[model samples]
Target: MYTTLLENIPMLFNDPTRDFVAGIIDAEGNLQILKKGSIRLVVVNTNVTILSAVRRVLADIGIEIAIRPYGKPKGNERQRYRVVIYGRGNVEKVLKVIPLQHPKFFSIPLFSSPSWGRKSGNERDPRPQLLPPPPGGGHIGGTAAV
Candidate 1:
């Protein structure tokens, strides 16, 4: 497939790849931060080509990852694969540029703006809470507050 051509090709972890990865994450992946538990950045899909590309690209940068392929999708669903990366060290590196979409929980305070917590949020405005330094002394993101 398309990914096979990349096998022998040298893929660099440059801006191009970062943008592609970010697009993929924004559309099909997520930034997961478990409350006082664990944090991980992952992308799952039924297409293996994209995931393979991700694996190879990250590998080029010396960041290792294991691609888990589901045995079966059951019923009429298509088989899928999950590209998972854990550990704060690796997650932070990816979080730097990988734009996360839904299912992403921030470690900062619930509401940066008091008005934001009103009975009804701005239905049209879908932007998440702006990231600001926590009162406990931490960076914008919840890397330490958690």
Candidate 2:
């Protein structure tokens, strides 16, 4: 079903296509801050066709990405394709077009902040501090503990 829909999507990125990509990001994407505070946007899926369509849509808007195999498939598991938008410039571009509707949204500002990823002296990290674990020590809600 999704393959057919993605295959037929217009090459140009319209509002509906933007919203659809945003939905895909909200569900399957990872807004990652690497160990050195560099930001990366990754959308993972089992279907390469869907990710190919996503890559084309993003390319139309001048954002580039690389599609690669995420992990080795286990028994009976499908191979996962990772569409990665690397570097601050690419991440910033993606954020402008696709507004993430998740708690990860809070991290968006960090990417745009002046202090983010800076190595100068005396400036505190712009990344949000992680909250302490819940009372029971289980995972927090769907959102990360922030």
Candidate 3:
């Protein structure tokens, strides 16, 4: 019976193109809202190490993830987890890898992300400034090229 239900669950939502990826990051908050008639999953942690450990477990379960690791808006220092799965029994399987100590779960939704962008510090160097416009047709300081 479970297999039949699982097969019918429609894995299409896991596709990377869908907006649902956002819900996975805000999974904690949006899980309830998105899961109105759908399956929900949650992976919880405030520590980077713990969160990473959870993600690795998911990877091992054959679910390739596109992670958007960043600090919470409230400045609570908790990193968020948002990803997509590529295989079956993912929710059930990932739960097996995570040790019972760390409270993260699949099959139940949680707060996730709406888009993917690396955190500020993690971005490339910001030291170099953009080159000024070309000497000819391009204007500078709001003055027409003279």
Best by lDDT: 2
Residue 90 lDDT (model 3): 48
RMSD of 1: 11.1
Candidate 1 error regions (>4 Å): 1-16, 34-36, 99-146
Clashes of each: 0, 0, 18
Model 2 misplaced regions, further than 4 Å? 1-16, 107-146
- Position 3, candidate 1: lDDT: 86
Instruction: List model 2 lDDT by residue over 102-126, tens digit each.
Output: 6664533443353444546876665
Residues 8-114, candidate 1: write the lDDT tens digits. 34443222375566666656665445554454666788877777777766675667888898568889999888887775657655654455443343333433553
Tens digit per residue, CA lDDT, model 3, 1-146: 99985774344233222222222333332112121222224434344443344355455556655545544656554455444332224433433332332222322222122122345757733222222222332321122222
**After superposition, which runs of candidate 3 have C-alpha atoms over 4 Å from their true positions?**
1-36, 69-71, 75-88, 95-146
Clashing pairs in 2: none
lDDT of 1: 0.57
How much is 81 displaced in model 2, in angstroms? 0.7
Q: What C-alpha lDDT, on a 0 to 100 scale, does residue 93 get in candidate 3?
A: 43
